[model samples]
Target: MSDPTTDPAFLRDPYPAYAALRSRCPVQQVPTGSGGHSSYLVTGFEEARDALADPRLSKNTAAFFAGKESGRRIHPAVAHTMLATDPPQHTRLRRLVTGSFTTRAVDELRPFIARTTDALLDRWPAGGPVDLVAELAVPLPVIVICELLGVPEPDRAEVRRWSGELFASGAPAVIDAASHSLADYMTGLIADKRSRPGNALLDRLIAARDGDDRLSEEELVSLGVLLLVAGHETTTNFLGNAVLSLLLHPAELQRLRQHPDEIPSALDELLRYDSPVSSATFRFTTEAVTLGGTHIPAGKPVLVAIGAANRDPARWPAPDTLDLDRSPAGHLSFGHGIHRCVGAPLAKAEADIALRKLLTRFPDLRLAVSTEHLVWRRTRLVRGLTALPVLASRT
Candidate 1:
């Protein structure tokens, strides 16, 4: 049987595949296409939520692969961030950076985000076909993140390229190379900040201290890399997916355009309808645990299918429909428990500004090509369009 996670057809529209797997059993072992390892794929809503918070399920990827002989080697800088740590370590790392992403902090960035959105939209060709993904979706978050991290204008392109490679599907070599390159780049950037302190977030992070403790060099570099990549990638894909969803569901799109005030509240439904992050990061069982009535052995890797969980029929009525009015109270797109995405506030803020500006600027904006021609990226970790070509209004 083909792996639904990687199959091209499934990649384009994975909901059906997720639904099929979810119907049978929410938790089942499936080949993850990584070193021939089969991971427990958790698809049920309740099951996925519980599994995310389960203490036995560890996120320490480096520790889990310590003795395993695998062809793919992840860099220490990439493998040792808060994303891969548990308990005290994760708590400490999260605490150090939490203030930077608070609602207040993100709100302070609204004017900048608005200016950036308007500038990008201003360049759109009049009544011509444009790839929204490339023109708006990709750069908005990338520029926002770069500004936050104090990355120089000249190096931003390289950072974007390396981050893109990090998420390439079925290319372990490229992923590893990107990880190392990004880590090294961040290490250099951190050193530069240390010598010449600036007012950017990276400078604050470099100077951050917790009593007698501070982030080590490796942790600093790792966190920088993590923030750079995670800070924008998810939001980039999210902008693309949210735009596509709105375009596809014209009713909802029109409703939002008519009542612009609803855009903020509508974001939750959009996220749940077609999540940008298909699956949460890799997690391993530190000890045997039962989830969804399935017994998973210790040391086994688990994949919480956020995409599947969000669309579970049991959790939401008419799971496949895009209903803006629906209350998306418990979607796991940003995840659950301690490991939930730290930059979610920023992502939401960017999306809010981008959508409001883009839709208002080109009220008649629409897909430029047939839906069949649209391309979805080949990665299972993130669900997004490679290019979202759309027609913009002349005005």
Candidate 2:
């Protein structure tokens, strides 16, 4: 089979492909985007969920990719973050930074989120066409994350440029370059913060303790890189995907418009309806493991399709339909178990505020372009629109 990662049709809507694969080979090797190395795509909800939490599947990319002729090197700063660590190392790294994502901390940023949303909406061309991807969805989270991390406002555009190039499918050279760009940026930022401290999440992380243990300089820099990259894309895609979903399902939009409070709960449904993340990061099997009655060999690269699992008919009734009231409690959009997204709470908070305000402020918000004319990015990692042109009613 041709590489689906680079396929235009597959990029637009992979759910059908996932369904087809799940029907016959839920756990089977597929061509990777890099044009080298075989990878397993686990599409079954149960299988995906279990594989995500299984300790037998290691997340250590450095160890797994060591000595491989993959043609790309995992940057040291990119490698040491919690997302790429196992057990003790992961636990320690996670403990040092979980405080900022707590409910209270997120709540404290409510005013800022509201301001950011309103400010962006204020710039909407008063009924003129605007690309929501660039005008709002892309920058809001970036700004919030920048402020949160003590990243200078002047440098966000460079940060964004690096992030934008990072998500492209299977370009090892581009990926390596982005990894280094971000790693270096974070390293410089950490050094600057140390010389002159401020009361920001970065400062707190620098000082955070895990029972006499602290994030080493490399871990601190790595965490900064992880948070910056993760913070920018996840919520941006979520917002874009959510708005696109709501626009496509007008009845659901009307339902939410009538009861704005539902928007909060509706987020869960939207997340499941069109998950921002198509698949969780790569996990390699440490030992032979049976999943969905299929035995996967050790030392094999595995990918859990989060988008596929959320839409699995066995778990979600009317799986393809947009039903805001459906229970989305167990959706794997943010993943599962210990490696689950640490920024999820903040992402949800941002989504909650962004959606409510966008809908309320422009009650007649509608897509400026035909649904079919919309272009999806050619990235296998994140399923999002490249440009979402919208018209806001300003009567």
Candidate 3:
């Protein structure tokens, strides 16, 4: 009925609101005012998954935004990225970058990820509180991704700052300005790669472009930004969130520590229980499509509530409770169908190594502050702590 963003009740924990909406009208259209208002906010498990796989719903926001008087212009650089492409193009664009995320490819990086984890932990003070997120989770992914993409070490910190602001929600002007700056930086990065090819993923992409014209120059540039952002941001949140959740549930943490192999399954449960991405990427309707007994008209945006869907009672028995043994294979944490995250294997590997290593290294690790003092990221989409302060015990 009201804008969910500003709703205090929704802010506390939106799952109740989502559950209520889905139960009452699964495909209800909530208004987003311009000339007209309505974007399907799909909340239910089955419906959200179905909508993700549907052909009628397009990811290319530029086309839909063009028809609507929403006053929002999709940046050309953002539009060229695969996230905004509908298939045939989405298919083509994804192919050019899939190799880096293949199971084989990700598996090969396991030892490196473990070493990175150990090294970060080793640097931690012998007996002191530390911000696990900053010292470990944040840098691990950025370093790994920078190495993977041939981003010069000197530019990594600046690029991460630019990328964070670009994805941040709210203040339309802020989003627009950040998007432009990121684009300019990406354009420059691509030029540098072209002039001096390094043995990095960016070089591989450039080589692919030169050899077969499969990816356009603009596409390569945008894809570089996407991979860097996607590769790091989400995993950073996942590691932080997983540690936060596990700490809150000490028994579960103890169980995982006892049987280290279960860390993989426990990671799945962490993903399903409290996903890094609370919602799927926004999608828009191309034509009037009736779903879940409600009709969403043509050219309207929809926010698929992935966190809500993951815990939908109809899909998972005892959904609200986190059960490590319960199979999370079908969860929408990595999304569903064709749009599913391609870098999932890498994300999983990084998280597994980070989480396991942290627990093992600091067997008596405990929170530095009260639970209420833990600050969450300002944006609701990527649910994570701003700081995860942990006291490392020598034992």
Which candidate leads in lDDT?
Answer: 1
- Judged by TM-score, which candidate is best? 1
Q: Write down the worst ten-residue block by lDDT for model 3.
A: 3-12
List pairs with backbone clashes in candidate 2: none
Residue 361 lDDT in model 1?
82
Per-residue alpha-carbon lDDT of candidate 2 for residues 1-395, written as tens digits (9 for 90 to 100):
57667677788788898899889967888776455767788998988999999999999987996786765655788755678899889998887778888889899998999999889888888886999999988999999999998999999999998987788776778878988999998888877887898999888887663224476778888888889889879899999999999999999999888899988888899999899999899799999988888888999889899999988998888899989877889999999999998889999999999988888888899999998789987776788989999998864
- Which portions of model 1 miss their true places by more than 4 Å? 34-36, 209-212
Off by over 4 Å in 3: 1-12, 33-36, 67-74
Least well predicted 10-residue stretch by lDDT in candidate 2: 206-215
Off by over 4 Å in 2: 33-36, 208-213
True-vs-predicted CA distance for residue 316, candidate 2, Å: 0.9
Q: TM-score for each prediction?
A: 0.97, 0.96, 0.94
Cα misplacement distance, residue 265 of candidate 3 (Å): 1.5
A best-first ranking of the candidates according to their TM-score comes to: 1, 2, 3
Q: Residue 25 in model 3: shift from native, Å?
A: 2.9
lDDT accuracy of residue 83 in candidate 1: 94
